[model samples]
Target: MAQTATRHAKLWFAGQAENWALAAYEIDELHEGMEDAGKYHPTHKQIKQAIPELIAQYVDQPLTALEQAINAKNKAEFIANYDKLTAGCNACHQATEFGFNVVQRPSFNPFANQAF
Candidate 1:
């Protein structure tokens, strides 16, 4: 159960990173990956039920920072802050003793329609 939770947490961060990268770049293919992560993420329930709402209450974050950064047209800022958010995801995973999975930055831009 602990390891499972860790995987879920890891997936959450990866998906969140993908989400922000896609949004910032306006890439449809990366966005599609993010969408898939959303659908298949392991922690979707805990995120909606506990983790996210709790963070929104206690911390200054919960991945919305990426959305705001992108909206502000600060791609550099988005990338910088995105590292922290992605780190948090890995932290949660490690805390749960599931350090096998490591999330990484997106390498290929898959947006078919628009350029960022």
Candidate 2:
């Protein structure tokens, strides 16, 4: 989840900077992180649904949309779908009783070593 969070923030910065390649890479990383989460922790004790199911229900569509936006290089669509993705993350967190771990767009970049 920590890596996902970092990738999420990096994705936002990359998209905001119009660095499509980096955004695409981050998106892929995010997808991989999701896959790993589902693979490693298929079920959460507090959540009735499987982790993979939650991911499919919430994150998948937005991720697809994000990919399309990246392909088109559409900033408006990218921002809109990014918010959707963030909402999906929050929805899953809420479902898993981790609502307090709300995710938002990065207010500032912490990865000073990497240029987006």
Query: What do the candidate models score in CA lDDT, each in turn?
Result: 0.47, 0.94
How many steric overlaps does candidate 1 have? 1
What TM-score would you give candidate 1 relative to the actual structure?
0.45
lDDT (tens digit, per residue) of candidate 2 on 8-107: 9999999999999999999999998898899999997778899999999999999999999998999999999999999999999998899999999999
Off by over 4 Å in 2: none
**Whole-model lDDT, model 1:** 0.47
TM-score of structure candidate 2: 0.96
Most TM-score-accurate candidate: 2
TM-score against native, each model: 0.45, 0.96
Clashes of each: 1, 0
Q: In order, what is each prediction's RMSD in angstroms? A: 8.9, 0.9
Q: State the displacement of the C-alpha of residue 56, model 1, in Å, after optimal TM-score superposition.
A: 6.0
For model 1, how does the per-residue alpha-carbon lDDT over 78-112 read when each residue is reduced to its tens digit? 66656765575566545445567666554444434
